[model samples]
Target: MVSAPTNLPSALAAALAERGHEVVVHTRRVDPDAPERQRLPSGVVVQQIVAGPVRPIVEQELAPWLGEFGRALAAAWRDDRPDVVHAFSWASGLAASAARQQLRESTLIRNGAAAAPLPVVLTFTAFGAEQHRRQGPVDPGLANRIRLEVALARSVAAVIAGSDDEVEELARMGVPRERVTLVPPGVDVSRFTPYGPSAERTDAPRLVAVGDLTPSSGFDTVIAALRGLPGVELVIAGTTSGDASEELERLRAGAEQLELADRVTFAHSAVRDPAARSALLRSADAVVCVPWHGPVGAGPVLEAMACGIPVVATAVGAVSDVVVDGVTGVQAPPRRPDQLATVIRGLLGDPVRCLGFGAAGADRARSRYEWARIAVDAERAYRALVPAALPAVDDELIHSNE
Candidate 1:
């Protein structure tokens, strides 16, 4: 269960569907007027459990909708039971836990026993400490969010931690080591292949960054970094066109102030399509991902690596784990434009090193962060709780039938 369509849950669901699992995503209906069920391109089924009008998940007012949402979930899952219900946020976990309890109670009283309590798994995308550290003071809902996350970790069959740091947090939360699984969020490597640096881009090297135009994202640092490399152009992707958001203006102002108007290009619309985003990443000579310290595997970095493009990312969260310094990609300190500029310049200067980083990154991404492997890992965790979840093929029966 998730509040809305987030990159992590949506990607995992699609990957799981591709792995032959019947993936049904349960989430809130952001569009009150639109259909509740959406069939996405990757063949995952989505069912929205609408509590009320659309609201952001992080807002404090969302707390009142929990009970209603849980009932909706219970109703949705009654006939079509899921082998494992994986909740993607603290609020979603609360709803899932309550719904699961309700289902169990009803099953026990109505039938002889409950159909072995559905192995509920969880993924808290951000650690509270990391959140506080990155943004300074925490939100009003943060303390409760952290508490709920800990409770979910203790209750769930397994926790899908994107980084090893999360596993440590789970241990501190008193969640058993056996129940925590280090399954980093993955990227689809098929479409994101390195088309070997663009043949058309002969004028100057280009660096691309994917995400929204926000202050905390550290795009200003990229703009600052681009000042030194006059030849290198920085492409900022994810903001929509014709909207005067202050964040966007601030970035524009920063570029102007830094005298980088010609060097920085803002692709004002988010390339939501994977193929398009992959194409954008593939077109670039290198990708820069220097967001403030946050959750692991925020999508762009892994996608860039998968596309066989070298990345210069800050050493935080999963970026630290995935990028092997000089091997796969370069790492810089968060909020440091000088280091980022130096690394970017170094990569742009040496085509061989950039290609090597791309090649190595592609190899690492394919071997360790493939969706098939991640799905199998998730399935294994589910199997630990529900041993009969996946049945083995009967080779003898097939042979006899043949």
Candidate 2:
């Protein structure tokens, strides 16, 4: 699997290994001292391949490295070919496409974001409005990147969508309907199950939100919703540094303005261990995911459901897919603070109802979103792409067979 330098692919690689599959994660760069290979209990292998340096400034550094990285992938594939190659981003898809031309036996799997080519101009106007509201100027590079991603997606054997909303987005971008597959992100249900009885919270309903505390995530909206709610405590676990620090401070000030300073707490500390993060999810009465911009998917929604916690989320991107209207959790319109507060208030008021939603969410997750099931589906897709034997035809053979 090829992905950018991030934690998403790392978790996926580990989960695939746990499902008894050999997983090799390829990123743009790697630490030389890192172990070359690690064997899991299921006998799966993980090989990390760092193609090159990934610099943020696209023109000065990333452009040249992209070409070099593509060539390096071709060279590596020529030495030893794998049965299937899964590419996570557009650049990875381009590399896998090049390698497939060299080694005719391998199947290419592609996954990433998709955007419409000519989104009625109003889309850009709306994006500009949102950008001006948060940041100063809109980045033109965002639109260009979306177009390139759409082009690269068309060249793969199968495209794995992280959400149903993303599938619709890809369809709008001219990808053939037959090639797209809806494979939403999966979670390790066992690891994130309900915590011990002693760890449960018995006070007022605890609402937990986790993500990079940025404007795009609409964390400010969540803060706004919690402002006047009595006896409700909000715990936000995520980073408040870099570009997001200013926004985080703004949110804190807002909470203070509403006289909710004591009720809200920001856990700037990282839950470095997965067990800790899982425990946090299990301890919460409900998980709140509110994003202003519609993302393809959010990991917290799945994690919360895995822990048997009802979710309250904005109806953006694939969030609706994970949080059924009243089954798993409640869905409110994006950026609507009042609606968000109302939903949370309703859920908190009815403990038995919220518990039922949490139970249904856990059942859904176990039945449909397990990593083991996803691995089997992925393996089946790979086999379908690779043929058992090559077809042979000659003048004499054709005549005799006929």
Highest TM-score: give the candidate number.
1
The digit string of per-residue lDDT tens for model 1 on 1-402 reads 444444236666666676666677777765677567877898777776777667435434567888888888888777776666777766677788888898999898899776777667777755665566667777868777767677778887777787877777778888899888887777777767776443234567888876445566678888898867778888887533224388878888888987888788776553666666777788888988887745645467878888888988887667777788999888888787888888788888899999899999999888988888887777666556655534542110000000
Model 1 clashing residue pairs (backbone): 239-268
TM-score of 2: 0.80
lDDT of each: 0.72, 0.62
Candidate 2 versus truth, CA RMSD in Å, comes to: 9.2
| Candidate 1: residue 47 Cα off by (Å) | 1.5
Scored by Cα lDDT, where does model 2 land? 0.62
What's each prediction's TM-score? 0.87, 0.80
lDDT value, residue 52 of candidate 2: 53
Q: How many Å off is the CA of 102 in candidate 2?
A: 5.6
lDDT of 2 by residue, 332-377 (tens): 8878888888888988889998899899988888887877776566
Error of 1 at 178 (Å): 2.1
